[model samples]
Target: MTQQHGETAEVRRDDGELIGMLRQVTDGGWVPCAVFGLPLATPRSAEAARGFLLDHGLGYLADRWEAREGGEWVTVQIVEARPGEVTVSYADYGHPKLFNERRTLQEPSPDDLRRA
Candidate 1:
C-alpha cells in the first residue's frame, strides 16, 4: 500500500507487512468513523486506508464497479461485507436504475458472478 499527498514521500508495503505499520501510527492520529457498523480505522492509518480491501473480497475505498445491466460505472461504498454477500451504497450518491432499491443495496460479491 502506498499513499501520496502534498509532497509527502510515498510509503509502500505488502499486505502482510501492513499490520505492523498500522500499529506505529499514533493514537492521536486515528480518527474514529463508521465502517460496516464497526469502527476500525481513521485517515491517519494506512491499514485503515486499505480497509477497502475487504477480507471477504477485493477492491479499494469507494471502488467503482461496472454495472452488468447498463454498463455504467457505479461507485460503491461497502456498508456490509460477508463471505458471499456485500451490502453497498451509492458512493456516487445515486443513479436511476441503481437506486431503485428502497433499502440498503445488498448485492453479491464479484467472485460470485460468472465471467462475461
Candidate 2:
C-alpha cells in the first residue's frame, strides 16, 4: 500500500493525554490516525478529523486483545496504554505463574484483529 504523508496536528484530551492526530493526505484533506498512527478513516476536512478522533477516543482499548507473538496470535491483557506505547501481559489459561510482559509500539484496533 502506498504510504500517506502530510503535515500533522495532534489532538489531545483535557488532561493532556495525546489522543490521536490529524494528517493531511495527498488531496489536502485530513485523515484521522489513532494514537499509534493507525489510520481510522477516510480523508476529511481538518475539523472533521479532530471530531472523529475525539468521538472515537480510547474506549475501544477496553476490550480484550490478541497480540502477534512468535508467529502466532496470543490472547493478551492490556496492562497499560499510552500514545505510542502499549504494555501487554499474556493471558494465563490455568497457568498461574506464566505472566509475560511485552511492549508493543502499536496496539491493533478491534477491526484490525477481527475477533469473532
Candidate 3:
C-alpha cells in the first residue's frame, strides 16, 4: 500500500475516507499526538487534542524520533509504546467518542517504516 503522510493531519478510519486530524508530537518519542475532529477544531473543541499533548509539551518533543505527517491523514492514535511493540486506537474524533477502538502492533522494524 502507498504510505500515507501527514504528521499534523487527520485520522481516517474505515471507509477509506477522511475522519479527523492526527497532530504528531516530536519529542521524547515518535508517537504523541492530539486528535481532533474534521475541518479542524475551532480553538474551543480542540481541548481534547491540546489536552492529550499538554503533559508531553516541551520535554517529549525534544527527545522524540524526528518525523512529520503534514495533512489530514488517517484516524489512528499511538497510545502506548514498548521496546518492541505499540498500542494504538482508532482516532476517529468525529465519532462522538474520540477513541473508538484499540489495537496493538508487535513490532515496527525498519522494513515496517513507510516510504517517504
Best model number under lDDT: 2
Q: Write the per-residue lDDT of candidate 3 for residues 1-116, one digit (tens) a residue.
A: 01235545333334543333344444422232322121122232234544433433323312322111243333555566443454555555554443556655564432322212
lDDT of 1 by residue, 1-116 (tens): 54434322122336522221122234434322222222234445444434432341232324443333345455555554442244555444567556533224333423322112
Clash count, one per candidate: 0, 0, 25
For candidate 2, the C-alpha RMSD (Å) to the true structure equals 6.0
Candidate numbers, best lDDT first, in rank order: 2, 3, 1
The candidate maximizing TM-score is: 2
Candidate 1 has its poorest 10 consecutive residues by lDDT at: 16-25
> In model 1, what lDDT does residue 80 have?
49
Give me the overall lDDT of model 3. 0.37
Candidate 3 regions exceeding 4 Å error are: 1-73, 93-99, 109-116
How displaced is residue 46 in candidate 1, in Å?
A: 24
lDDT of 2 by residue, 1-116 (tens): 11223487788888777777777888989988766655667899988888888887875456566765555566676677665556667774643444575556465554433221
2 or 3, greater by lDDT = 2
**Candidate 3 backbone overlaps, count:** 25
Instruction: Kindly provide the TM-score of model 3 when superposed on the true structure, using C-alpha atoms.
Output: 0.28
Ranking according to TM-score, highest score first: 2, 1, 3
